[model samples]
Each structure stands twice: as C-alpha cells, then as structure tokens.
Target chain A: MIARLLKKNHSTEYEELLEQIAQGQPLPTDELEDETRPMAQAANWLAQRRAALDPRPGYVRASRQRLVARLQARGGKRPWLHRHWGDIAWWQHPLAHLALVMLLVASAFLSASRLAVASRAWLPGDLLYPLKPMAEQAALLASLTKEGDAQLHIEFAHRRLIEAQSLVFENRYEQLPAAVADFDRHVSQAVILVNQMAGDQQDEARSLATELQQALSGQMGMLMLLTNLTPDASQAEFQRLLMISEDGVSDLRNVLTPDGGDAQHQGWKVTPRVSMHWLGEG
Target chain B: MPDRQHADETRLVQQAQKGDVEAFGQLYEFYAPLVFRFLFSHLDDRLDAEDLTEDVFMRVWEALPGFRARGVPFGGYLFRVARNALYDHYRRNRRRSSDAELNLEWEDNFHPDPAESVPMNIEHGELRASLAKLREDYRTVLTLRFLVGLSTEEIAVAMRRSAGAVRVLQHRALLSLRQELERQESEENDRQTFKEEPLNGV
Candidate 1:
C-alpha cells in the first residue's frame, strides 16, 4: 500500500526532479525512488549531449563573413530614401522638386477648402463641428499682424455667437455652456490684442477696436434674443454669455474714449476692467 | 539570456531597425552559429543550412520594423524566423512530409586541422537513427533544447507552446530516448554474445 501511494505521486515528484535538473542541479539518485531514477539519468544524458553539440569554428567564421557581406550588399541596395544622402537628393531635382511642392500645396488647400465647406453648416453636436474651431485657430495663428489677429478673433467670436444661437435654435441646451465659454474666450482674446498695441499703432488699434465693438454689439443683440428661447437647464451659461458681451461693450467704449488732458488715456491706454466674477468678489 | 545581454540585444535591435547594418552584423555574429546549427540539424547540408540561416536573417531585417522587444525575446524571434524559413525551404522543394525530412547527420567535414578531416563514425549513425525513430515534436523539442541550447521559455515561444507543456514533452522525450538507446544496446550486446559463443564452441 505504501509503495503504491509513493508510485502514484512519483510523476509529480519527477516533474520537480526535472525542474532541478533543468537548472543544472545534479540528480539526487540516492534520494529518488526507483520509479524516477531512470528519468533522472535520461535527463542527465540529454544535458551531456547538449554540451557536446558545438558547431565547428571554421564554418561559423566562413558563414559570418558570407552573411555580413550579403547583409552589406542588400543594405547598399536600399533606395535613396534609406541612404544618408537621401535628404540632399530629395530636393536636388528642380523640376521634380517644384512638382512635389505644388502637389503638397494643392492637396493641403483642397482638403482645407473641403473641410471648411463641410463644417460651415455643422452645429455643436455634429461630427465635423470640432474641425470648425480648429480651422478658426489655424486662421488665427496664421495671421502675422496684430490687426489680422484682432480681426480673426472678432470673426471667431461672431462664429461662436452664431453657433450658440444655432444650438438654442436646435434645442441643444447641453451644448450651450461650451459655446458660451468659447465666445467669451474669443472676445477676451480680441480685447487683449487691441489693448496690447504700442503708441504708434494706437490709431490702427482704435480702428480694429471699433470694428470689434460693432461685432460684439451685434452679437449681444443676438444673444439677448436667445435668452427668451434658452431653457432653464442652460440659463447659467446664457447669463455668463450676456455678462461677457456687456463687459466687452463697456471695455470697447473705454478704449474708444480719451479725456482731452487725462494723462492715463493720452496713449489710448486704460487698465482692463476686472471681469464680472472678480467684481462680485470685490 | 541574462538581463545585461538582453538589454544589449534590445539596443542592437533598435539600431538595426533604423537601418544600422553594423549593429545587425554584431547581432548576426552572436546568433548566426546557433541558427546555422539549428538548421543544419534539420537540413544535414551545410550549404543549405548556411543559405537558409542567411535567408532567415534577411527576413528578420525586413521585418525588424515590426518587431517589438517587449513581445518576445530576440533569440526566440530569430528561431521562429529560422523555423519558418526551414518550412518554406521544404515546401519549395516539394517534400512529402516535414518530419520525415529531418536528415540529421554529423558534419564529417569538420576538421581540427586543415591537413586532416574527421569522418562520420558508427556512434553518430546510431545516435542519428535513435533521433530519427522519435516522433517529430519529440525530435524538435530535443534538438531545440539540447542542440540549440534554448531555455525552456525560449523553446516555448519557438514551438508556440506553454513552458509547462514543453517541460512535460521534454521529460517524456528523454525517457523515451533512454528506453530506445537501452533497447538498442541490449540487442547489440546479445548479438556480440551470440557471435562469441559460436567461436567458443568451435
């Protein structure tokens, strides 16, 4: 009965023995019962064979040379794009280079135009609507001068006001807060741009500021029309939009005015007013 | 591999992926012999083994961009590439069966000195016969484990089996090999005794 039980557990015991042997531990034949001794011996023999099976040195050397040569030859055959001189060669051909440049510009302009047209009618929840803000940003960034910058920001502010009204018109109250925030940001960005102008650019800044003020006044009137239509779920966001537009109009008024002898407004300078939330804290 | 060597291999693989032929050459130096031996055991033809080993590395170079060091050890990946190349070789040659095609013979061309060459001996023939008698998976497990000196985990990846399964298979294979060798030894001994006994009677 004892021998039978030990024999029954011998397979598990042999697995353990195999693990030890695999780790290069010597087989403990004295401790192992007869059932696993043959397996242990066989494992040792296999390990011995593993030790003896070394490839000839001459073959390894010759094979290495051949492989290295082949690898080098193949590596040399790769196209100019993979070579070190690839960058220089890429722009060396005058006609091909001109064609490549033309192709890239044409593709970029075509894609941008298509995206703009498709996204023009897209509203807050539409799939391509996100591209609208991104395109506005790209346009804003591409403007090299402060006048263009302020103009782009005013245009984007108008777009946001339109988007917000469309959301209200479409009963998309959940999207109103994002549109309000975007409108406030664009308006603030425009105000900051016009205010940062130097003394020499004050006249230009004043002109841009007047255009922005007109745009904001039109947007404010449109926003007030939205108040009656906006639901309670989006009342807080609509109120925030109204406050932003009121502050924007007031700031523009201050920018457009200067006391005849007041030193502070001589250079078309007035400190920017604290926002409504900040005023509430005060 | 130890952590140090594995780290170095990862670095080399990264460089090779960027078309660094010198770094790939170093990798070939380290693994080429083992790969050649692995193919030789199956091909029994040195030139074929050499060609297939080169083919495997070429394929590896082409596929290097997609190789993720985190997925499998470089050694395991190389062997998998070698095994696939070997299968492709057999397929292209219109072989009947892959297992039946294992023509493992000792390379008699191996020479300690240029003036003399070793010849194939009887023990190698017997060993080859013994290996030939084993099942295909059994033969592969033994060749990869013993001849190639792959760790169990590496063998598992190369064979596409679990480490535990490889261990079990290895254990069974060794035991079976031992039984076959002992049976052959017994028959040889019996024949020797019978021939000597006839001489004694004369």
Candidate 2:
C-alpha cells in the first residue's frame, strides 16, 4: 500500500524533491514520510559525492593544449603533391617518367570509376552528389554523336525529374529547387542538342525530338500531379517548371509534325518510341 | 549566465560545423572534464577515462557537420557518443578486466577542488566504494544524475529510456545503494568490534 502510494505520488511530490536536489535547493522541513527519508538521505549523499569529483586541473590543461595542437595540425595539412615534389632530375629518366604517368592515369581511372559507382544513388544535399553530375558530363563528352549526346541528356533529365519527385515525397523541400533546376537544365540541353542537327542527321534528329516530346508530355502529367501535392510555398516554382515542360513539349511537337501542330490536335496520341516507362511506374 | 553560456555554445557549434577547429577546441575545453568524469566513474580507471575522453571528442569533431540541434541538445548528443565509446572500450577490453581491479584506489588519487579542500568524511568514502559495487544500470543512472548533473529527461535521452522509467530506476537504484551502504557499515562495525574485543580480552 505504501509502495503504491509512492508510485502514485511520485510524479508530483518525489519529483519535486528530485527537481529541488537537481537545482541545488535547500531541503524543506521534514514532511516526507518515514519510508522516504532513507532515499532522500541517499540522494543527499550522492549529491555531496558528486561535488567531490573534480578532474585534476593539470590533466585538463594538458589535454586541452594537446587537443588544440592536434586540431591545428589537422587543419594545416598541405597537398600531397607539394610534399612529394622533387627536382626535375627525376623526370629526366624516360622509363621512370612513363611509369609514373601510367600510375597516375591508372589511379585516376580507378578512383573516378569507383566514385561514379558510389555516387550513383546519392541525391541532392549529399556530399557525393556533385560527383554524379560530373560523371554525367564526362559521359556526355565521351558520346561520339549528337544523337548519342541527346539520348544521354534525356536520360540524365529523367533521373533528375525522378529525384525532384523524390524530394517532394520525402518532404525535403529545401533540396527540391536544386533538383528541379538540374532537371530543367538537362531537359533544355537535350532539346538544344536535338535542334542543332540539320544536315544528314535530320531524320534521326527528328525522331529524337519526337522522343523528347513524348517524355516531356509524360513528365507534364507527373508535374501536374506533383503540383497539387507540393506545399503552398513551393507551388509557384513547380508551376513555372511545369510551364517550361509544357512549352518544350509543344515546341517539339511542332518540329516533329512539320505542320506546327500538336499530336492531340492532329487526332492521334504520340506513341513512345522507346520503352515508354514513366517515373514512379513499375 | 546559463542562457549566455548556451548561446555561446550554439555559436561555437555553428562555427565548428563550418570547419572552425578553434571553435571545436573551445567546445572540448567546456565538455572534456564532464566527459572524463563520466568515463572515469564508469570505467574506474583514470588512464582509460582520459583516453576515451579524447576519443569521444575526436568523434564529436568528425560528426559535428551532421549534428542538428533539432530538439536534442549538443550535450545530450555528446553524452550519447561518450556512452558508445565506453561500450566500445568494454567490448575490446572485456578479457583484461577482473574483479580485483574494482577496488583500485579512487579517493587517494581524487584531485579535490582547491577552493573546496574539505576532507572527505567516512560516509562519503564508504558511499563512493559502495557505488562501484552496484549493477551497471544503477551505477550509470546515479552517475549521470549526480555526477553529470543531467535532468531526468536528459538521462532518459542518454539511456534511451522514458522519463518515468528513469525515475523508477533511479528510486530503485538509490534504495539499492542505501542497502549497500548499510551492509558496508555493518561490515566495518563488525571488523572494528573483532579488533577491539581481542584487546579487551588481553
């Protein structure tokens, strides 16, 4: 019965006692029942013992100095190349120079490939996310044809659009603008690349433009769905991006049909040339 | 004063997050002793405590960039790190410890504050000794409560328990400690009596 009473009153009375001790308050008159005195006394003794625990000043001072020195040392690091550079004499030996060049190239290739693979899944706001775009740019430069470059740009735009949708879904609104901006840039670049082809690659260029129109059409539907889901503060930006996507899709449809009219106006749905997969679908 | 100190710490944490090593060093200065005392009370070894204190700060420095002060204070985060470091130390050194080491001299080596140079009484000494004999959770609750001066909520965050559970555990721990102190006191009395009775017989 006493234990039950203590448990019932613990939130108020005993808690007040604990709060008072925690605040270093002087104890009040002896109103605590007999069952509580021993615990209160134990608490008092524990508090007193707590006062006795003082870390040696010498240790504290010495450790602080050592830690500051270590922090400074860590902050003052120089580039490894600066430390390893020697006179040009080492470069005079062609074999040594060739081997060093090969080693540098091999290490760079391995590290870049590993970083690209590691950063593949990283989104905006991640430390490795910048590497993802750098890798995509490197891939764009490696493509041998304008059509190939346009396809790569479309692929990158698709990834960024998915990332933007994910940012909205995850409620990371701060990074949403960055992801949307990236998607806009990629889509714009893909359209420009498709428009640049005029001479012998015209047929393929028109086909790529048609594909771009289809993708943008599908993305327009996704963006409209997301606009309703986006928070009020970000709705304006989402609408602006949606308008840009609409304009791009209209411009591509005019270029594809050669009559400056949309596929819907021409009385036929634009069939997707590729796999026709949209974001968030299986 | 506490408000000003908290503001200063918040500013320092922000600067540290931005790669200011000096700001982090200042944080180390503020929290190192508390971390050391907590570690020492748990491990009962001065060297291990100091080493783990340094390790804990190093980790805090590395993890400062990701630390957001969303509801959880930096001190609570730091104590959590210290607890993890203590557990890691135990796992690594489990085979090296034996029961004999628990009785190592604590008061003899305790560096009392120069301003408060009052000598410890017998009860304080006995209490400190008996504290080492309690179970891990009891000792930890008491140490974080009294030595570290954490509130029940902070202790709950550190121990990953609810505030009510912490309160109940603390009450049980204090009762257990009182029992331990009584047991030690009786042992000391019986030993003294045994010594004096021989002289009385003589």
TM-score of chain B of each: 0.82, 0.83
TM-scores of the models, in the given order? Answer: 0.49, 0.52
Poorest 10 consecutive residues by lDDT, candidate 2 chain A = A82-91
TM-score of chain B of 1: 0.82
Rate residue A252 of model 2 by lDDT.
Answer: 55
Model 1 residue pairs with clashes: none
RMSD of 2: 23.5
DockQ of each: 0.09, 0.14
In model 2, the clashing pairs are none
For model 2 the TM-score comes to: 0.52
The list of candidate 2 runs beyond 4 A from truth reads A5-9, A23-31, A76-282, B1-7, B98-101, B105-128
lDDT of candidate 1 over A48-126, digit per residue (tens): 4433334555665676677668768775244544343322322344654565555446548677677666766787788
Tens-digit lDDT string for candidate 2 (B44-112)? 455677888999987777666667676667777788778878866764665443223654454344435
